[model samples]
Target: MDQKQVRQRIEEIIDNNAIGILSTVENNKPYARYMTFLNKDKTMYTPTSRETYKVEEIDKNSNVHVLLGYQGEGFGDEYVEVTGTASIRDDKELIEDLWTDELDNWFDGKDDPKLIFLEIKPEYVRLMNGRGEPPHSLDL
Candidate 1:
C-alpha cells in the first residue's frame, strides 16, 4: 500500500478500537497497561491519573508503544503497532473536548485535578496482519 492508504488504514484501526494496550519503558524493561484510547485526526490520547506509575514512567522515558485495532479475542487479526513519544498533558481544554460520561466512571468528573491525558505523538506506525502480509510503515 502507498503511504496514504497505509495512513488511512491506521486511522481506521484506531477509530474502530476504543481501548488499546500501551507500553512504557522503565529502566529498559517494559511496563504495559490497557488504556482508554482517544484520537484527534491521527494523534492518540489516553487518560490517566496524575498519581500513577505510568505517568512517572512517561516522565522518565517518553518513548512508548501502543497496540491498537486488535481486541484481544482472536488470532491472526489486524492491528496497528505505534511507536511514539508520550507526555503527561494537563490540558483542561483538551480534556473537556474528549470528555465523555463513560470516562466519568474513572475520574471524579472532568474537573478532577487528578485527571490528565497522555499525549502520544507517533513517530512511526506499522500496520500488521491487515490487507497484506507485508508490514507497511505509515508516516505521521
Candidate 2:
C-alpha cells in the first residue's frame, strides 16, 4: 500500500482496537504491559498513574513500542507495530477528555492527583500480516 493508504489502515486499526501492548525500556531490558489507549491524529495516549514504574522508565528513555489490532483468530489477522517517543502528559483537559468510568478502578476520578497519561507519538509504524498483502510501512 502507498503511504496514505497505509496510514488509513493504521488509523483504522488503532481506532478499532483500544487495547494494546505498550513496551518501554527498563534497565536495558524491555518491559511490556497491556494498556487502554486513545488516539487523535495518529498519536496515542494511555492513562496511567504518575507513580507507575512505566512513568519512571519513560523519564529515563523516551522510546516506546506499541502493538495492537490482532484478534487471535490465527493467520491473516492484521496488526500494527508502532515505534514512538513517549512523554508524560498531565494536562487536565487531556485527562478529562480521555477519561472513562472504567478508570475508576485505578483513580478516584479524573481530578486525582496521581492521574497522568503517556503520550506516544509515532516515529515508525508497520502494518503486519495484512489481508492479501505483504507488510507495509506508514512512513512518517
Candidate 3:
C-alpha cells in the first residue's frame, strides 16, 4: 500500500483497538502494564491517576512504547508498535472529550484530583502482520 493508504490502515487499527500494553522505564528497567487507550488523530491517550507509578516514570523519562491493535484470534493478527514520548495532561476540554463511564472504576469522577491523562505523541509507528506483507515502519 502507498503511504497514505498505509497511514489510513494504521489509523483504523488504532481506532478499532481500545486495549494495549504501555511500557515505561522505571529504575532503568522496563515496566509494562495493560492500559485502555483512546486515539485522536495519530496521538494516543490513556487515563490514569496522578499518583501512579507510570506517571512517575514518565515524569523522569518521557520515552514510552505502546503495543496495540492485536486481536488474539489467530496467527495472522495485526498489531501496531509505537515509540513515543509521553506527557501528563489535565486539560478540562480534553478530559471532557475522552471521558468514559468505565473510568469511574478508577477515579471518583472527572473532577477527581487524582485523575490525569497520559498523552503519547508517536515518534515511530510500525504495522505488523499487515495482510501478509512484511512488517514496516510508518513515517511520522
Compute the lDDT for candidate 1: 0.88
Q: Write the per-residue lDDT of candidate 3 for residues 21-135, one digit (tens) a residue.
A: 9999988899999999999877899999999999999999999999998888766688989999999999989999999999999999989988999999999998888667888
- Residue pairs in steric clash, candidate 1? none
Which lDDT values do the candidates have, in the order given? 0.88, 0.93, 0.91
Q: Comparing candidate 2 with candidate 3, which one achieves the higher TM-score? A: 2
Q: Tell me which residue pairs clash in candidate 3.
A: none
For candidate 1, lDDT tens digit of each residue in 49-78? 999999999999999999988865565578
Q: Which lDDT tens digits does candidate 2 get at residues 1-140? A: 78888888888999999999999998999999999999987789999999999999999999999999999977889999999999999998888788989999999998899999999999999999976899898878
C-alpha TM-scores of all predictions: 0.93, 0.94, 0.94
Q: Which residue pairs of candidate 2 clash?
A: none
Ranking of models by lDDT: 2, 3, 1
Q: Rank the candidates by TM-score, best first.
A: 2, 3, 1
84 in model 3: Cα distance from truth in Å? 0.3
User: Could you tell me the lDDT of residue 9 within candidate 3?
Assistant: 77
Q: Please name the candidate that would achieve the greatest lDDT relative to the true structure.
A: 2
